[model samples]
Target chain A: MVNYIKLIQNENMKIYRRVGTWIMLSFIVLIPILVSLVVLLAGGDDDTTSWPLIMLESYFLFSLIIIFTVVVSSDTVAGEFSRGTIKLLLIRPWSRSAILLSKYIATMMFALFFTIVAFIVTMLINLALFGSTSDSNDLGGIVSTGIVGWGDVLQYYLYQFVTLIIIVTFGFMMSSAFRSSGLAIGLSIGFLFAGNIITGLFAMADKVWVKYVLFMHLDLTSYMDGGTGPIPSHPMTLGFSLGVLAAYFAIFNLISWTVFRKRDITA
Target chain B: MSQAPIVRLQDVTKVIGKRTIIDRVSFEVRPGEVFGFLGPNGSGKTTTIRMMVGLMGLTSGDIHIGGHSIRTDFPKAIVQVGAIVENPEMYKFLTGYQNLLHYARMNSSITKERIQEAIELVGLQDRIHDKVKKYSLGMRQRLGVAQAIMHRPKLLVLDEPTNGLDPAGIRELRDYLRLLARDEGTAVVVSSHMLSEMELMCDRVAILQKGQIIDVRSIRGESGVGSKPTLEEVQFDVDHPDAALGILEGQGSGRISDGLLTLSSDRAGIAAINRRLVEAGINIYGIRVKTKSLEDQFLEMTGSETIG
Candidate 1:
């Protein structure tokens, strides 16, 4: 267990040491402050309705988090192979699975760190610009029939985080299967956007098999928003969406682990 | 050297598609000895080393390190080994000390003092905190060696370790490897096409040709002394080179060139031939021993295949 922790620590150190990682992190913090400054400069109404604005800013920031997570996870394994560092890493006393698991854990930690930083920066800036209020307009009509409050706001971010995990894991799986980080990132982001289109197409079909499609279940927040998901007639519930997401998560990780463990460090 | 074998390859073979990258090659490396691997380009030296280090899978057979099989119990088997497969590729973003620290974390036995000692052993103390991207190739190689020894592994495997080192750096690396073997009792396996460096560094060498073990030669004699003379072309500078060749008629064949008679003979045969030549009234100017180098022997054994 201690050795595993050491491996994770080493991986984290590698990630943090890169200038690119710091730049990405700085962008996470800076983008929200920049946006807040722009809104204030543009002379928007200061009606003390800060929660809704903060949540909106956070939603925008979360999209960036998704992009950053996908990019970082894409680079985690494939970058090692391209750089020939996998040879150095694989010869260690730890198992191959352990080394890969440490990388996954570190990438996840990076995602969490960025999410938290963006959340804090957006909250601080919005509070300074528009002040705090207990109004429930921050729910943003995602929940139509509930007394949406700070709890729902937290749940919204949590749901976004859960969705980001699938994207990150998808990128990670691509990385393990391929040696080019660019290809992984391209495929992952392509999938993220293309999945919605595919889900929309599937929604038009009355076929029962469309319910089992992966992308149709990726947006777990649809259930939180009291919407019937992309397919209105399908009666998508939170439990069912969570179950589907869990299955896809398992499949993604299974593919990543198997491919990473079985890969030969030829380069 | 009666130490137990630290590494053993038993008929290890690797096939990629229809090509056999490594044939049924087998060898053993004992503790506290430096074993050299030599082969021409595309001869499977790196392939074999990769298999030994578990960087590549073997098509058949197994590799046992310290009584653990790599095919079955990889972690247990690999714990005894520290290897740089080809060039030592590290995270260029991290400093040299950070790189060593990262590698040291993989094993529980490696400590802070040991990391410092490895850095000092490799003579990277002054620049240990510099990022690896700022380092020269030789400095990177030194840092590679530092990381490889931090765990005090029972076996150290290095492929082309002296690729970019200057002569002095190579000598320093050689001395450090020797020290590792002698003091830490680590079995060092080094593969290189540099025959001269191999001659000076290795206790014994196994030469490979076309993915097969062609010859295993001891650089130093069995008794560890320079007394036992091997077969070499002894050059004799004589007053009358043609007359000296006539005196050696019944002995091995001889050729005269530039007033020197050259013939293949051991130490005793050279002594006897000299006496016969002197008695036959041929005054000897000088007799020089031209020892057959590893390069010559490698060329002869491998059918003169050029090394890359």
Candidate 2:
């Protein structure tokens, strides 16, 4: 267990010591603050809804997180192969699975760190610009009829985090399967947007298998709104979406581990 | 008590796609010995090293390090090994010290003191805190050696370690590797296309050609010097080369060129031929013994395949 932790630390050091990582982290905090400033400058602050309004406005910031997560995770494995550093890492005492697990865990930790930073910065800006109040209906259509509070805000972040986890894991799987970081990042982001469109198209087909598609369950936040997602007639409950996401998480991890462990590292 | 060989390769083979890259190459690296892997380009020296270090899977056979099979028990076997395949690539974003520290964390036995010692051993103490991107190629190579030896592994494997080093750097690396084998009793295995460098550094060398080991020669001639009478080319500069060749005809292999009669003879055979030539009224101007260098021997052994 201690050795595993040391592996994680080593991977984390490799990630955090890069200037690009720091720049990405700074953008995570900076972009949210900039969006809040733009909204305030547009004379949109006097209407003062609630804290959840800032969280809703910060939903776009999650896209930046997605970009950050995809870039970091894509570079984690593929960059090692491209730079030939995988040879050094592979000859160590640890198994390939252990080394890959450390990289995956470190990438997840980076995603979580960006999520937390986005949450805190968004919350602080919202409180400073528009005072926090107990107005239950101020969630601005994000939660249609729920009595939203800090608990709902926390739940919103949780759902977003879960969705981000799926995307990050998908990126990591691509990174492991491909040797080119550009290919991995391009394919991952392309899949992220195209997957939703494909899922929407599948929803119109009236087939039961549409529910099993990966992107159909990516937006766990849709369940928070208490409405049918993608397929209007077929409603997906929170438990069902969680279950679907869990299955994908498992499949992505399985592919990543198998490919990474069996890779020849010839370069 | 007899100690087991530090590294043993038993008929190790690797087949990629439909082609065999390495074919049943086997050798052992005893403790405190510098073993050299000599081969032409595409001759599978790197492939063999890759299999031994577990970078590439072997199609057949097994490699044992410290008595642990690399195929059956990888982690246990790899723990006793340190290797740099082709080039010692590192995270250029991290400082040299940070890179060592990162690698150090992977093994529980590697301590902070050892990391410091490795830095000192590589003579990187002055620039240990600098990022690897700022380091020169030779410095990076030294740092590579430092990381590989930080764990004090029993078997240290290097592939083409002298690729980019200058003369001074190469000499330094040669000295350091010899010191590692001598002081730490570590069995060092290195592969290179530089026959002269291998001749100066390695104690024993294995020559590979077309995915097979054709010969394993001792650089010190320990096996060929005292135990057996090995053939050497002796050139006799004589007053009449044709007459001298006539006098020494059929005794051994002889060829005359430019007033010099060259004979392939052992020490005793050379003495007998010298006496015979003088008695036959052939005045010898000078007799020069042309000891074949490693390059000549390597070309002669590998069918004179050009090394890239």
Q: Looking at model 2 chain A, report the run of 10 residues with the lowest lDDT sum.
A: A138-147
* Residue-by-residue lDDT tens digits, candidate 1, A47-163: 335566666677778878888888888777889888999899899878888888899999999999998888778778877876665454533354243423457667777888988
Question: How many Å off is the CA of B234 in candidate 2?
Answer: 4.4
What TM-score would each prediction reach against the true structure?
0.90, 0.90
Give the poorly placed runs of model 2, Cα more than 4 Å off: A48-53, A134-148, B222-231, B234-288, B304-308
Q: Tell me the alpha-carbon RMSD of every candidate.
A: 3.4, 3.5
**What is candidate 2's lDDT per residue for A143-172, written digit by digit as tens?**
343524567677778988998999999998
lDDT of each: 0.85, 0.86
List model 1 lDDT by residue over B1-308, tens digit each: 57779999999999989988889999999999999999888899999999999988989989999999999999899988988877889899899999999988888888899999989888899999999999998999888988887888899999999887899989988998898888988999999999999999999999988899988888877634576667778899888888788768889789987668999998899899989988999888899988768888888888865644
Q: Write the per-residue lDDT of candidate 2 for residues B1-308, one digit (tens) a residue.
A: 17679889999988889888889989999999999999899999888888989999988999999899999899899998888888889899999999999889888999899999999989999999999999999999999999999999999999999999999999999998999899989999999999999999999999999889999988885645476787888899889888777777778678887668987888888899889988898888888888888998888887865643
TM-score of 2: 0.90
Best by lDDT: 2
- Evaluated at residue A264, the lDDT of candidate 2 is 80
True contacts kept of 2: 0.86
